[model samples]
Target: MNAKFMITPVVFSMLLLASCGGSYSSNSSDSTNSYGSNNNSYGSTANDSNKNDMRSDSKPMILTQKDVLETVKSKINSDIVVMLPKDIPLSSDSHFLSAKTTDAPDAYQVIFYETKNPISVNSDDLKEASKATAIATVSGKSYMTEQEAADATGHMDNVNTGMNGVDLGSNITGYTDAGAGSTFLNWAEGRWSMSVRNTTSADQQDSIDLAKKVVAMLEKETLPAPHQVGGMKLEAMPNKADGNIISWQNDKTDYTVSNFKDPLDGVKITTSFTK
Candidate 1:
């Protein structure tokens, strides 16, 4: 008997985003939002109480971009492509918070925080910096055979057929729900499955238009080549607060460009990685 592994890289990517402090609030102005809010109390000394509240025993080790990349690369043996933007937008003070890797399924993650304070990649302070502005992740497991991959792909096609709406070029399928104020686009390209999700828009056409823009942007880049192609799934919602997420998967690796506050930022990040 052969062992079978079922990997949901897209969902795993979402969980990683949440664990790293990605915000799902529709109200971008909310100071309490998870990812982009600058109201965190770190590095603040406005009052005596805050000064005393600072951790005295330890300080998070600040890391440069190169350091984080090296740390992540050192741990994983898989030749996975790590996608990241040339520059993180919104704040000049942003810094790398952590680089993590996991086995069994083989995964890696890199988090970028928009903060003025120094936070170690593996410290409690990193968790407190939940308003992380950006995150990039790759994860996946090997399939037993081509039949398994085909079955997974066929199942996904059947599952997502109902939500299909707009037709993005290059076989990309777009689904827009005006009532729910959400849009989801999905496709398979070059041994990879890709998707973009936005829950903040209400107009169906607006959502479709944005999906088109993202698809167009992805067309100009060179995507990672995996060992095999697998199944794809599509899901959407309107007025949801999950922000924007762009996720993709190859035969044995899953990639994500996420935690961005704006939909266009997601596009920028995706294109940057592929470029």
Candidate 2:
């Protein structure tokens, strides 16, 4: 799986403007409502506690190596064991670290990066001083439907990067934004979504390369056979019409999962086996 950090467009522009040393107008409601008073750009959940965690002046969260390990182990619930590249460095600094899980449909992530000492988001020189860091990120999610993935990515224009050796003009949608010495890529195949961002030009290929590697890995892994998972009893079967299948039925309902090679582009597909 691929992982990328996302910031709102207004937030991105805000950073650019702030970097230019301009102050916001006190009387401007349009600016004050979104960016000034609430700062929704950083996200409403990113309350003062998160800000204090990123800034060095406040009390450190004091995470240990074991704490990081336990946090990762506790959240993982998938059978697929995706691996990242070898060279990405690891650190425990709160400013450059994050790990969490999202629900409704299950997902988990663990990310770590190393930067210079005394990292501070509020510092004037953050853009220049923290340009280089070793970042490693891993994420896994299971979606009940394609629309769920679409909702998360905001239905952005998906582009074919040809990173996975698919045909030209494949419909696999994605988003890419490059600026401030950084680049980000996000794409999905079926119900699975992946993202990668690189601030250091040196590691720009890391996300792309890892994405392809993951595609290759999942393509070869064994399928989840029909069995009892969570509380449902799934049964593995073959459908000559729809191809191979793993299905579940409980009196009133039925669910099926299957894989197919997307003819438009060869991005390995595991999708609901709908007729």
Candidate 3:
């Protein structure tokens, strides 16, 4: 993506936030937009970077953190990373987007959605349309000249832009049912996501804001009460050793690389891969 298009992941995620349906035309003025980042001791939840349209991406796809990061490295440039489900496009037509995932790991199974709900605009047309006016006031050529904007509705593809969403809080943990409620207070310990799409600006903002609240909760979210429950030794793979490759083709899960984190250091990059 270009620097002008370098909005935050929250924006894309928020785009498909709810069932928000903005009716953009083919003659809106140019718009400008900016933004940050987060993550986890995560178990690859569809890297749900911001998408447009209220798509359902809370499902656990067969993806790992390493696979996503590597894809970003190989395919995208060095600006920022906006991960989405393979169903949504990389455009400004809708409110949400999702990443692309495969059904059997190796096969290419993807879905992209182009929202019919843009306030419509032209690049050459410099009309005065702010994000706030997109809902009710903004319309076709009222915001821009005919030549100012192009049919930018097709900018995005390969993301699930029509999925649904719910909510999050400190109580939710792991992956739970989408219909449980809007706010899954017990989803997980780190950051959490709901299976519902937030389509409106307020809804998207709420989602992002809720994420922040969870991060705040992370500092205070209670850990499992210390008991006789079994636990594994807590250790980070060396930051400089070959990353452990957990995949299907290999007999074992880990195929450590030659340049993994330092052997003696207290960090490592454990990668989850497909067979």
C-alpha lDDT score of every prediction, in listed order = 0.49, 0.37, 0.25
Residues forming the 10-long window of minimal summed lDDT in candidate 3? 134-143
TM-score ranking, high to low? 1, 2, 3
Q: lDDT value for candidate 3?
A: 0.25
- Best candidate, lDDT-wise? 1
- Kindly list the per-residue Cα lDDT of model 1 for residues 61-136, writing each as its tens digit: 5777557646655665554444444443434555444534554434455555545565444445545536343343
Off by over 4 Å in 2: 1-157, 161-176, 222-275
Better structure of 1 and 3 per TM-score: 1
Q: After superposing candidate 3, which stretches have Cα over 4 Å from the reference?
A: 1-63, 79-275
Clashing pairs in 2: 158-173, 158-174, 159-174, 226-234
Of 1 and 2, the candidate ahead on TM-score is 1
Give the top-scoring candidate (TM-score).
Answer: 1
State how far residue 186 of model 2 sits from its true place (Å). Answer: 3.4
> Where is model 2 poorest over a 10-residue stretch in terms of lDDT?
230-239
